[model samples]
Target: METSQALLIYNMASVEKCPETLTAVNASSKQLNCSIDTYGNNQYMCLPNAEKSSLVEFCYNGIMGIQVEGNCLEAKDGRVILHSCKKFLSGCPKKPFFNYDFYKYPACQHINLKHFCYESDPSCQALENSGGFNNVSNDNRDIMYGLIGGLLVLVILTIVIAGFINERRWKRWWWSFTGVGNEPDRKPDKTSGTTTNPGL
Candidate 1:
């Protein structure tokens, strides 16, 4: 695909980290209002239902994807759903999972990953091809920058050339206005062997 087409796809992945508010659905099908809280490890957590949950802590680790406990969440329609494994049954069951709505997150519109949660989803397939666009976008950006630089150089050259031409014209005008260097060539007349004045 062309770089422009790939850029559109790549831009879709660049999302905002925070928004005015966030909404989520818990395992109980209860709608929860979540808030963002940043920590020291370049990680952040979501506090659900206006308070903290002891059993379920939704945190986003910058390295991978969003996670609750240790399990990765599946992204869909700008939201992430956590499918708990059997071992974490005490915290979250396999039946109904915890879903966090990151639709309001401006930096990243969507998150896609191949994990325990809905691995067969189409978004997961997109993740497999996401790597190709990065390099393509970088090359395109470099080309764009080069084009801008070349235009700047052309503008400078144009200004320099215009200045040189204008300076010559201005000097000629000034000399004529002041009647300087307007004298005719004072050559001797061949027949008379003497200089002749045109005014005489």
Candidate 2:
């Protein structure tokens, strides 16, 4: 997909993740910064590490009917930290402490981790391999230039033809008005043997 298309998908997914409440603060190649304030004091920012995480999560959850977690939530080095997920979780116990700071990898480990997605995400790879994003084919460019050139030539030809027709019309009108070539030929009268005005 093209960058604009991918960004559109990403934005759509971000909206769907929160549905009319998400706001994108900044979007760049390195990260997508977004925030949600609908949940009162529970306001939070969703920054996915990979460029296509929003698109991937949207496809996975909305289209594939699979539950995708840790997409918009925060993480460190592609691993979802406990504190980050806890903010969104409700009625969860806090007494039982775990040694590990990050949650265990999900079954779809490849998709859940941001680093893995960045490196080997199928959608992004397909988009890149298809030469659709940020890449233009030479043939398409050449065709565009050819069409422009043809149109320019057509315009010039039409102007030239119009000018030629106008020039001919002007010459005919000037000749008629000035009597430059419409004067009757004078001839000597044989009987009189001299040229003479009939009126005189």
Candidate 3:
């Protein structure tokens, strides 16, 4: 699965076409650093007008979503382009770097500004196969570690149980580290009607 792709309608909210959608894009005025390509199903998904005459379109069954994130790059010309980054969109509204009213237009909250969704492309599967944005992010890596760590817990517990069984059979002197048999049971002497301990 692509690490990330153009969002589908389900992934986002309130769908509409913005011919002036370029207002939502931020190219950093720098050259596009990354050049990864994804294909929609039979047809392509959205192509970057900015990326020469490369015609990228979507081909997933119906219009699911898109992966490349862009906004109204051509919004100024009243023509819309979906190739903006809005890299700063996460910590929006609550702590906006540049204040813009997002409540009225939540999509306006896109820090990459140029963020938009599109129809699903079956051919886009090619892009999906090529891999997504980058190696698993640090947060995702942490989650992976956690899942692995959790699974390892079961292994640890199984080892512990096995150790207990072995300890019972062998009576090892070094089996105390796990605190498995820390307490010794006290038995009452019927004749003396008194209690005595073994470790003492």
Number of the top-ranking candidate, with TM-score as the measure: 2
Report the CA-based lDDT of candidate 3 relative to the real structure: 0.33
What does candidate 2's lDDT look like per residue over 1-200, in tens digits? 11111121233224323222222222221143323223321122233334324422221011111112332222334332222223322322234422111122221122323233432335535555665533667888788789999999999999999999997777768766895642233345789776554555
Expressed as tens digits, the lDDT of each residue in 1-200 for candidate 3 is 11322322111112232211323222210122212223322211222223222222222223323323333221111122343334323321222221111122233322221222211222333444455545578899899899999999999999999998876655434434554543234456578976566657
Model 3: residue 11 alpha-carbon error in angstroms: 31
Residue range 1-200, candidate 1, lDDT tens digits: 10110000011122122222433223212222223223323122332211111112333323323333433233332233433323331323223222243323211222222221222334444555565646467779899889999999999999999999997787768766885653343456789876676767
What CA root-mean-square deviation does each model show from the true structure?
A: 16.8, 16.8, 18.0
TM-score of structure candidate 3: 0.26
Candidate 2 ranges with C-alpha deviation above 4 Å: 1-48, 51-71, 74-76, 81-136, 181-200
Over the full model, what C-alpha lDDT does candidate 1 score relative to the true structure?
0.36
For candidate 3, give the lDDT of residue 75: 17
Cα TM-score of candidate 1? 0.28
- Per-model TM-score versus the true fold: 0.28, 0.32, 0.26
* Clash-forming residue pairs, model 1: 14-107, 15-106, 15-107, 15-108, 16-106, 16-107, 16-108
Clashes of 2: 0
Q: Model 2: what TM-score?
A: 0.32
